[model samples]
Target: MITVSACMIVKNEERVLARCLDSLKGLVDEIILVDTGSTDGTKEIAKKYNCKIYDFKWIDDFAAARNFSFSKAAMDYIFVADADEVIDEVNREKFLTLKQHLIPEIDIIQMMYANQLEFNTTYNFDKEYRPKLFKRLRQFTWTDPIHETVMLDPVVYDSEIEILHMPENNHAVRDFDIFQRLIQKGTAFSEKLISMYARELFIAGEDKDFLTAESFFTGLLEQEVSEEVIKLIQCILVRCGRIKNDSELILRYALKNIATGKASAEVCYEVGEYFYNKDNIKEAVIWYMNAAFETDAELNIHYNKELPLEKIALCYEKAGNTEEANNYREQAAALRESLM
Candidate 1:
């Protein structure tokens, strides 16, 4: 079996560090903990896990910290983990088997970063996968600072290995604080940080930052040119309107998004819902029809609750399309049943 090195870079994570390392104690051959100036006993906990701890200065760049940690690994494969993540028994078994005979050609392993959770009997965000495992021999490097990404050669071996993220979010404390620092220092904002700062600004209900967020998001799109990012920009524009009730800006993005083919199902639905709520049935139907069968596979991002389908069904019923109305009515019932 090949040796697996579990590595991490953390600071002020005393509360969750032990639990994170404990979960992987059996799965990895060694643990490498890199502390970026932790005042807490984070390093002391690392010693308990027999981790080969290293010290790095607190640079605002997460990629720099992460890359420094990976450089110290003395194993064939390196598995990176956050202090907030834990591996379940099923995933542990899979990792052990994969380590035994990892293909030489494979540069990275894409594991499922499951983010689903429940609180007081309500289902929260759905889970998604990200490439987290690596072969240090391939010299794979991480890029960006905030939402850092691993740069690997083509054809990453897909592993069934999955991790459950029991996140202890101090978003207001840690994330925004970093953004505040970057802003105060006049650092030429990283694209990743721009996305994060925009999100945090939105969450804080800051209207002035809406325009700034729009510019940064659009700039990121121009630099990276991703459809997903464009859709997010549209989302911010829509939310800015909702929070401010500024119909002027809302109408601009709504129309612009429709033109660019970047509008989400939620966006179209919201536009439709706005008209529907205002008793403008015809306009609402046009928008809802566009949303219901959106071409963007990612556009249906968990907001198509029964109400949206039911609303569309009602719209169709009013438009005298009994067939479409009944079809949507059935869909609404099925969705409601599934949720129940």
Candidate 2:
């Protein structure tokens, strides 16, 4: 049987920390908790578990904190965990069995991270596979018969264990602050980070958040960028234009987005919102129809799903088309039900 070290980085997670630790108790051989400046009873709770605890200074970088926690792990494999996550009894047994029977050649283990849509964070899916466990040390091996080369890719295994994510509240506000800080510091964003930032904004950003991101996304338009990045930038600018009530900003990008011959649901929804706010119900419904049927969503799927459907239903009701309104409402309800 292989020993597993559960590692976590947390701050001010006093409310849910104990619950998470309780679920992890017998499954892992050891626990390593790295506290990033917690002024709460989080340390006291860690003491109850008799886990190895380390204090890490807040560096505005989660990777840094995670790496610190992983460094303290002394077991054969390190299991990355979060204070907002837990494993149920069924999955806990599965996890323990996997640990006992796992092959030594496997370097990474992926587990399903479930209950995502409840808080509707950056992800669109309710459950997805995420790398949760790792072999502490990797042994290099050569492959092929004649011209041998070292294997570069880690051997990965997908496990049946599912980790339930039960956060008390959405962390978008905290994530937005970090994104804004990085943007203001002129830090270059990788393609993945750019996509994640756009998704988080579309899912939970307020008017102020869009306004704050307006300048940065607009700057990207002036540079040479990928087509996908351009689409993301267009979506961001459209929301910013709508929030600022700038018709020129809206129409400019709306025209650019339309010229791409592949309009995005986000831009279409924003256009519908623009017309709706102006009381042009007919034009709004036309754009909303485009959002629902014509364009694919670039960010949040709800823009192409329930959001436009709900608005179309409202517009029809306002236009005295009660039958059509009911039809669209029913379609929206059915769509949501199917996803559930």
Candidate 3:
């Protein structure tokens, strides 16, 4: 059987830490918990689990803390876990079974991460595959009999084990703070990070959040970027303009994308919101229809799906068209149910 070391980086997670450890009992050979300055009873709970706990100084970088925790693992495989995650009895059995039968050649294991929409975070999918287990040591082998070359890619396996991500609260505020700090330090954002930041803003960001992020996204427009990244930045600026009630900023970005015939659903939705608030039901309905059918969403998927549909329903109601309003409302409700 392959020995698995569960590694976790935590801070002030005393409330949920015990529950998470209890769920992992017997499934992991050892637990490595790295605390990043926790003043609560979190360390006491880790002691109860006999975890190999180490203190890591907070560096405002999650990757750094996670790497520190992984370095302490001493098993054949390392399983990255979070204090908010729980594996039920059925999945626990499946995990143990996999640990017993997993081949040595497989270097990575992916598991389903469920309950994403609970807090309406950046992720669009409610359940998606995430790499959770890694081989502690890698083997380099040559393949291709003639003119053999070293294999560079790791062998990966997807498992049926589902881990429930049940966070006590939404962490968007904390994440936004980190992103802001990174931006202040002049760190260049990867495309993935840019997209995630835009999605988080659209999903859970408040007016203050949008206002604070406006200048950063606006500055990005002055730099040369990919077409897709430009579209995402445009969407962010349009939303920011609407929140700040700056008509010039909103129209400047919105018109440019519309003229290119590549307007994203988020831009269309923002335009619809602009008109909707002005008591222009007809114009709002047109824009909402464009959002739902004419354009694809660049960030939040809801902009192209449920959000526009619900708004269109409201627009029809404002126009005194009960039949059309009910139809659109039913469509929106059905779409929501399908996601569930």
Candidate ranking under TM-score, highest first, comes to: 2, 3, 1
lDDT of each: 0.71, 0.92, 0.92
lDDT of 1 at 117: 33
Q: Residues 64-156, candidate 2, lDDT per residue (tens digit)? A: 999898889899999999999999999989998997899999999999999887887889888899999999999999999989999999999
lDDT of 3 at 253: 94
Model 2 bad stretches (over 4 Å): none
**lDDT score for residue 124 of model 2:** 85
The superposed Cα distance between candidate 1 and the true structure at residue 283, in angstroms, equals: 6.4
- Residues 201-251 of candidate 3 have per-residue lDDT tens digits of 988899899889989988888887788888888999998888877889989
In angstroms, how far off is 143's CA in candidate 3?
Answer: 1.3
Clashing pairs in 3: none
How far out, in Å, is residue 81 in model 2?
0.4
Better of 1 and 2 by TM-score: 2
lDDT for model 1, on a 0 to 1 scale? Answer: 0.71
Best to worst by lDDT, what's the order?
2, 3, 1
- What clash count goes with each model? 0, 0, 0
For residue 321, model 1's alpha carbon misses the true position, in angstroms, by: 18
